[model samples]
Target: MRERKAAAVRERVREFALELPGAYEDFPWNECVIKVNRKIFVFLFLGHLVAGQGDSPPTVTVKLAHPEAHAHALSAPGAVPTGYGLGRAGWVTVPLGEPGAPDAGLLCDWVEESYRTVAPKRLVARLDAERTAPPGA
Candidate 1:
């Protein structure tokens, strides 16, 4: 049951990332790497952390922005401090709970923020141009 739910959530996330402007699939883990003009924006490690856990599914780490949100995630079950250099930048590692631990909306927002943060200024400007461009101009 938990596996099914986690898969569903992961699929939703994958779909969201697939729609990003310049996102693409990455090898070795089939990880989703969102980019803007070839520059990496956000990385999805859905199956990258499953070596030791065995039956338990791998964890998901989303780069967080607000200090409050980071704090909240750290207190949840299955949640842990993000490893590597992301910890210094306020990324929180939240485990996709059994069937229904992570909130979809919150995850979506985090994903979006992560993508935006790593995107280059020039690409962002291009996105803005597209968004603000007239319907047919």
Candidate 2:
């Protein structure tokens, strides 16, 4: 049952990642790197959330410019302090427990916020223009 649940989580996360606008590269150590117009906007890492593991399934950790979003995520259920030096920074980690608990939309919101937070103002403007422009126009 645990294996099945983990597989489901992996599939869901992968699909959600692919749905993000712009191309991405799946990096080593279970990291997802998204590039918009050849610029990196988001990088996601999946690490062991539970102890006693050999390559555990990914729990989402997003990078933020400031600490507000990180604080908010920490307040949410299933979200916890990221260990191994990341928590010391402003990274908040969210676990993949009951899928119903933290739905994909909410996770995607965090990803979107992280992208906006890290991306430069000029790059963000370009991305925003691309987003608002008519498809293929």
Candidate 3:
């Protein structure tokens, strides 16, 4: 059933997001959230979220560094701007369990971008350094 499939997809996406530096999961408000430095960067909404947007259980919301990135995220199928004025600040909703949705690789990239956008400068700098560091370092 789709429910089982949704769970699998959510788990995969959750694992990918959590692997990022400083990323962690919590259930404040009983809602699944992924954060960095106690600041929310990703929210995983399950069931009836954004009703009519898609037939997906888990919809992933991320905050981008700039509103310009909004258009790019929304260009993907089943992706939309987060409502309640969040969209005005560069937030986007990515439907995780929807058919034709972005694969885990692309979704992980988005998660990383969102993490960098909201993460503290020190954490971001560390991530940057890791990228530039040699293979063994």
Candidate 4:
């Protein structure tokens, strides 16, 4: 049941990540990742998608370049710095389907932040422009 819930949340987050400009899915190192312009912005772990793959929990790892956002994300239960020295660079892993876990909205915001951090400046600017553009204009 927990895995099912986590998978649902993971799919929601994945869909949100893919909506960003230049964002696309990739499988490197046999792991799922969402990248923009050749740089990985989000790493998604298995969440009931492949049963018996392992005993690990479902989680999403993203780089929080902003200091306050980084701290806020770490405050969530089961949230932690991403390993393999990525933690030193402000990457955080947020566990899903757990108590005190952040909601899909917050996770999607972080994914956008991560996208802004790694995507080219032009792409980032384009995203910003699109956000501020008037409706039907």
Best by TM-score: 4
Looking at model 3, report the run of 10 residues with the lowest lDDT sum.
47-56
Off by over 4 Å in 1: 28-43, 46-54, 125-137
lDDT of 2 by residue, 16-107 (tens): 65555554655645556565555544444454434554565556666555677677778766666666776676667666554444555676
Give every collision pair in model 2: none
Question: For residues 1-137, could you state the per-residue lDDT of candidate 1 as single tens digits?
Answer: 77677777776776776566666655435766555556444455665464466565545566667787777767767776677667788666666645346766667667666666666677556667876999997
Tens-place lDDT per residue, model 3, 1-96, is 756766676777789878777889999868789999999888888856576656456777888765556677798677877888998778888776
lDDT of 3 at 125: 89
With candidate 1 superimposed using the best TM-score fit, by how many Å does residue 74's alpha carbon deviate from the native?
2.6
Using lDDT as the measure, which candidate wins? 4
Better of 1 and 2 by lDDT: 1
Task: Give every collision pair in model 4.
Answer: none
lDDT of every model, 2 decimals: 0.64, 0.61, 0.79, 0.88
RMSD of each: 3.4, 4.1, 2.5, 3.1
Task: Show the colliding residue pairs in model 1.
Answer: none
Q: Candidate 1 local accuracy as lDDT?
A: 0.64
Candidate 2: what lDDT? Answer: 0.61
TM-score for each model: 0.71, 0.63, 0.82, 0.90
